[model samples]
Target chain A: MAMVEIRDARKVFDGGFEALRGASLDIEEGEILALLGPNGAGKTTLISAICGITQPTSGTIAVGGHDVVKDYRAARNLVGLVPQEVNLEPFEKVWKTVRFSRGLFGRKPDDALLERILRKLSLWEKRGATIKSLSGGMKRRVLIAKALAHDPRVLFLDEPTAGVDVELRRDMWDTVAELKREGVTIILTTHYIEEAEALADRVAVINRGQILLVEDKDALMARMGRKTLRIELDEPVAEIPAGLSDYGLRLEDDGRVLVYDYDTSAERTGIARLMGALAAEGIVVRDVATSQNSLEDIFVGLVHDGQEEEGVA
Target chain B: MNWAAVAAIYRFEMSRFFRTLLQSFISPVISTSLYFVVFGGAIGSRIDQVEGVSYGAFIVPGLVMLTVIMQAISNASFGIYFPKFIGTIYELLSAPINFLEIVMGYVGAAATKALFIGVVILVTSSFFVDLTIQHPLAMVAFLLLTCVSFALLGFIIGIWAGNFEQLQLVPLLVVTPLVFLGGSFYSIEMLPEVWQTITLFNPVLYLISGFRWAFFGLSDVPVGWSLAAIALFTSLCLTAIWWIFRTGWRIRS
Candidate 1:
């Protein structure tokens, strides 16, 4: 069964900012879904609506079969959220903060469980330390531990590694994967396309409060991405010389190299024809390299396409 | 209405407040002592007795009430305001605890702090003036009621405030002025008849008067009337707090 189902959700703030516009999606149990978007794309707003922190302007959201509005307690109990900001009580001991979060879900205090959670996050050594005294990366881990303290079936991590260093980011990603292995469904929003591509089972692209697509990660990568050939010449040329313009070639840095961007979905890339044209233009290529499609490429293409559509509208 | 959540949050919040033991304990004791020294000692030298009690002893209950009110409001407002400042309110809101439980936890902790300070001030004031409680039970009841009511008021203020500046506005500017004008240092009878009638409109006057009556067994107003007014105000403040949490005013979305 789906752990979360958002049906036509919309949020219009008091100042008339429409953060979410009829966003609908289903999150299955035990799946890690990555929400990819730029800033102001409503990722955080959507997560807030799902967690019952904010009421929707219109539409319905249910978590674990409980409506977020009508049965908030049950719904909230089924989900835990690690917000983008570090918000623990600074004066409280680390252990107390995690344990208190569990109790907030109306769960009974279990020392063994709390200790396990702390240990898993590598925070047991500092259980007695105050939150304000912990380091930045440790504080981020504390938030994750707090969210997991209640043992919710689903976890929402909104940019969990936004400002963290590389080493800490990898550690957090590994921990998230481990949690997914333990059957906790995870929904994450990130500006790091590689993080999504590396960790997400499914990728959902959202722009301007609208969802562009949600697809299986591998299939989406295979279907929409493109490849590019970057040709560097021995010498810079003045222009494309008019004859090579039909190959969709872009001249970079006054024709130091010619860039050819082509869809991988096409039958042929016409690399031989392009080379023939470049040779006929008396441009000798010193080095030629091919690049495969990456999540970042698809993201840029989608965003650019979105912008063009908005421009037309 | 989850007692366990309320208890947990209350315990955590209270622990945080007490974590700075020196600041929490010393600040109130020193402040209360200064009030006694400045008001009860310096000002009491010239003022005559009120209702057969020395001016210093007569003002003891009012002074304690003022401390409790100020401490309660400050503690509660800071408790909520700090979380917001650090952006931790998202975790609190996303938690399974309902609005009532969240309010109960923070405000409950604040009330506990105010109660602790109130007791310390009362005990410390005994050193300055020959104060006596004519009705021990009434005194305890008024202290607890005033602490809780003012804590609720502070919780509302914390929610309404978007930033740190706004947090200090109500407590320092609005509430404190009203409290001082409520006759914490002097009886309303000392004022002209018109001002005395106007003082009755200040809610803190009824709270302090009810507490003062419990101490000296005498007041410018009837003891029962003062008690009734405080009780009504407590109920009204509690109802408004409940409504604010229910509607998620300023805290939600």
Candidate 2:
């Protein structure tokens, strides 16, 4: 069975705001599943529901085969959440906060394990420092360390690098990679496609409270992805000529370039036909190139598709 | 129940309480001393006695009860409210513990703190007046009940309050006035018959009267009624908290 299973999870908040609309997914164990979405896309809501912070308006979520609501203790015991908010006892030292979190989960004190996790996060040096005295990046690391204190089966990082600098973001990515290598199941949500591309084995695109798609990152990019063919003419023109008007290609670089978007999977790409038509129109080509869409383009397209669905519904 | 979880929360709150150790210890002692100077010395000189005890001694139970109840509520309310304010409450909510365990941690710590402050005030009061506990066992019972009950009420208020202002609203606007009017400093017998009957309705009056009875063996109402009143309030607070946790109201949503 999947480590975490959310089926038909729907959260209609007060006054009919559908924060989550029948979202469902199965998270495989021991893999980093990045939930990719934009703001107001229900990423935080999903984590909240799964972590037992909030109940689903309707649906069932199970962690390690334990239902979050019916078997809350068992389910919550299997997961730890690093929330987007940096909400710690400002007066408490970092080490004590982490130790307190472990105790809260009914875990016996293991100073050795705690030390290892803190050191891994680069927070060991600041263990005696009060949380409020640390920089924002260090505080974020403290939050992560606290979540890991219980040695949970799954760790949910909700927008972990939202406000982090580039250097800290890179550090966080390295930490996540090392944890994944240690056989820990990590689930992170972010709008940064770069983070997802760098870390996630599988990516789930969520928008408007629904999972747009959940697929292996490579398969997702290869399937929904579109390829573009561009021709740079030998001479510049203002617009496409009448002879090539039927092809309806995009004109850019002062009409010096012609771009055609097509599916790579299709047998007839129309690239050869387009090139023949351009030649017949006496348009000389200086250079030819094809570019596959990056994950960012795919993410934007998915969000746009979800918006169109939002408009329709 | 998870004893470790309860202990964790309890210790965390206690550590926070001690972080302001200087102020926590000094403020109550200073305030009790001032009350003694004003109510016990300046005011007592004119009024010889109430119920055959010296004015200074008569107000001892009243003053202790006042401090214990207020301390219980404020400490418990702030204990829970700060976590909510800072968003650390999510960590608690997502943990493997239940609501009862959470309460045991917060309310337990609050009661302990209030009890500690009550003892300090009692010692402080002893320096100012020749006070005696006629029934030491009964006094401890009364003190414990008052501490736990008020701490529960504070927990409810902490969860119900949206901001810091609301956290203090009840203790300041409702509690202080009730304690002052509930025969804390004076005998209710001094009031007219109709007013005396009216004063019986104040819940704090029962706590003060029962507590005073423990001290000098004098009370405005029967000790039984006072004990019953505490039990009733305790049950009410429990029910409110149970409902809050069940519905996941305010905290969950």
Candidate 3:
């Protein structure tokens, strides 16, 4: 069963800009769901709606059986949000900032538990230092520490590694993995396809205020992914040959490479027949290589398709 | 009523307050003392007394009221503005606490800071000239009420403001002028009859008059009327804040 449910949630900002247009999805308990989208694709808006920062223009959201609008206190208590920005109180000490966050949720003070989280994030040594004195990466870690201070059942990280260095991004991924191993339900939004491919159990694609699709990570790759066979010709052709048109072969690399896009799931790939046809057409193939479409390519394709649809409208 | 949340926010604000401890305490003390040297010394040597009290003693309540109002508004405005500027307000909004608790945390801390500054100014005033209290409880009440009301007004300004210019606009343009012209340094009676009536229309007059009456047992307006004016102002500020939160104006969208 889904742990959090959003029913056609729509978030329209002021000036009639619709950030989320009937966007909906359910997050499973203890699973990491990565929401992938381009800029202005409503990724952060959807998270903000779930976290109760940005209220939905219409529809409803429930977390742990509590409605976000009617029963916000209960719903908010069940979720922790590490927002897109590292916005810690500059003058506040690290431990105190976390303690205050825990207390803001009406929790009793637990220094020992907080200390453990600090150590896990590697922020233990800087616990006494003011937030302004910490480095950018450490400050991001502090944001995560504060988010987990109250031990929220569900956590939302909006672009957790938007501007972080590669090393810090890797560390953040490890920390997220550790949290998932410990039974925390994590939902994060990112435009980085590689991160989503690496971290998420389920991936949802959103574009232009709509969720295009949501599916298991590996399942989605295998289902939508296709391989392209590129044949490097020893000679260049100015135009497509009439004989090879039936095989869906296109000349690329300025007519020096013959490209054939074929699905891996086909009962018979027909590569041999296509080669024979190409040879019959007197197109000498010097070399051949097959490359699978990556998640990155799929993301660009989906976003491009969405824009084209909008342009037509 | 999430008391823990209120306390948490309040403590964090106070921590920020103390982070600039030397500046907060010393600036008020030093500035108020300058009022003694310039206004009290230079002006008092010419016209020594007003309303049967020495010139130095006469402006004590006015100076304290001026500082308290300004400090409360500035501290409160900056308190809420910084969080919004840095985007940490989303954390507070997403927390399990309601809007009222958030207001209490911020306004309460701002009021407390103003109150502390008021006490410090009062102590500094005592060193320059003698002061007597006719109604100690009323004086304390006026001091606290002004702190809270002005802080609430400042909270409103902080929410309504979109930039630094708007943040300092009202405190600099409207509030300080009202306090200074409303009879902070000189008594309303010192002006001509027409000007005295015009000055009575200034809302700040009632606050300073009531506060002065607490110290000297004399006022330009009846003490009851002054109390009524402030009570009305406090409720008006409260009503404005309550409406702002209900509508989620500026703070929510």
Candidate 4:
């Protein structure tokens, strides 16, 4: 059975802004699920609802068979969340912050376990330092440490690497991977599709409070995602010839480059056919390169299309 | 529901206050002492005993209550406000800790600070005035009850407030004015009959009058009535705060 199941969940703020519109998804036990979306895409809102931070306008959510609202204690006990912002008591020491977080979950203190968590997060040395004295990256780690303090089976990270340095981001990825190894189901939201591509087993894309798509990472990339083929001509021309119009060719930089976007999910990508057609049109390609569409490109394309459609209406 | 969690959060918050050491512990005491010197000593020279007690001694319990109330509000409000401001509240909210645990932990810490300041001010008052505790246990009980009550009230204010300025509004505008007008500095008997009748409606009057009763066995209101008012206020405040937390009002959603 899935460890976390959210069904037909909806969230409408007090101002009548619908943050989540009947969203639903299930996260398998011990799997990493990455939520991808633009700002105001309801990623955080959905996560908050699941975490019981905000009650859903309508729907049922359960964590390990415990209804989030009816059995909140059990549901909350099963999951941990690290929010986007770094919020800790500035005067609190790193160690005490983590320890107190554990106790908040109604857990008994185990010095040995706390030490292990601190050492694992590489915060053992700075455990005694006040939160204000730490750097931003250190503060972020403190949040993570606190989330793990309770030893929950499920973890949610909201924009975990939004403003973090590359090094820390990499370290956090590794730490997340480590947590997954310990059989902890992880859910995360990120604008960086590469992070999702790198970490998630399943990906859910949300836009304008709607779930655009949710699919296996590889399958989504292969299916709804597109690929691009570009040809750098040996010389610049004024315009594209009419003969190549059927190929949906786009002229760039005074026609020095020709670009074709094709569906990767098609039985045949038509890359070879497009190249042949370009040659027949007397467009000598000096260099040809094929680029698979990244999750970012798909996300931007989907959201932009949605916006344009909204504009038209 | 979790005693362990409550204790841990309590200890952590209390330690944070003490960690500042001089800034946290000494600043309030010094400020309260100055209030005593200026208002109790300097101002008392021309004013006779307002309620059958020396002017200096008459303000002692009120001043102590004032100090306790201020510290309780300041410490408790800031305790919750800082976490929200810095964004650490997400961790607490997401933690397995229930809302009750969160409130108890924070209010407990706030009460601890109020109690500590109440004691320090009580000791400091001895240096300036020769007062007696007519009922030591009643005084202690009243002191703790008042501190915890205000601490709980402060926690609600902290959670409801979104900014530092908002946090200061309740203490500076509401509580301070209430304390000043609550008959802390003067007896109700000195006011006109109309105003004297109105003074009975001030909640802080009950607290101050009750504490005065505990000290000198004299008060404007009946001691039992004051005690009942305080106890009811504490319970009511506690219930409201608890409900706010449970609903995640302004704190989470």
Candidate 1 lDDT, tens digit per residue, B47-142?
A: 868768898888788878888998899889888878777777887788766777888888899999999999988888888878778899999999
Which parts of model 4 are misplaced by more than 4 Å?
Answer: A225-265, A268-288, A304-313, B28-53
Candidate that would win on lDDT:
2
Better of 2 and 4 by DockQ: 2
State the fnat of model 1: 0.80
**Best first by lDDT, ranked:** 2, 3, 1, 4
Any runs in candidate 1 off by more than 4 Å, and if so which?
A229-290
- Which of the predicted structures, 2 or 3, would earn the higher lDDT when compared with the native? 2
Superposed Cα RMSD, model 1: 3.5
- Which residue pairs overlap in candidate 2's backbone? none
Worst 10 residues of 3 chain B by lDDT: B244-253
What would the per-residue lDDT of candidate 4 be over residues A172-200, giving only the tens digit for each residue? 99999999999999999998888999999
Each model's TM-score for chain A is 0.89, 0.90, 0.90, 0.92
Candidate 3 residue spans exceeding 4 A from truth: A231-246, A250-258, A271-288, A310-313
Candidate 2 C-alpha lDDT tens digits along A1-313: 9999999999988779999999999999999999999898899999999998888999899999999999999998889899998888888999999999999999999999999999999899999999989999999999999999999989999989989999999999999999899888999999789899899999998988899899999888778778988889999878788877776689898888888888987778888888888889888999989999889998998788778876952
* Model 4 / residue A296 / CA error / Å: 2.4
Models sorted by DockQ, best on top: 2, 3, 4, 1
Task: Please provide, for model 2 over B1-253, each residue's C-alpha lDDT reduced to its tens digit, 9 standing for 90 to 100.
Answer: 8899999999999998888888888999999999989998899999989979999999988888899999999989998888999899999999989989999999999999999989999999999888888999999999999999999999999999999999999999999999999999999999999989989899999999999999989999999999999999999999999999999888987
Clash pairs, model 4 backbone = A87-B87, A87-B88
Give the whole-model CA lDDT for all candidates, comma-separated. 0.86, 0.92, 0.91, 0.86
* Inter-residue clash pairs, candidate 1: none
The CAPRI classification for model 4 reads as medium
Q: In CAPRI terms, where does candidate 1 land? A: medium
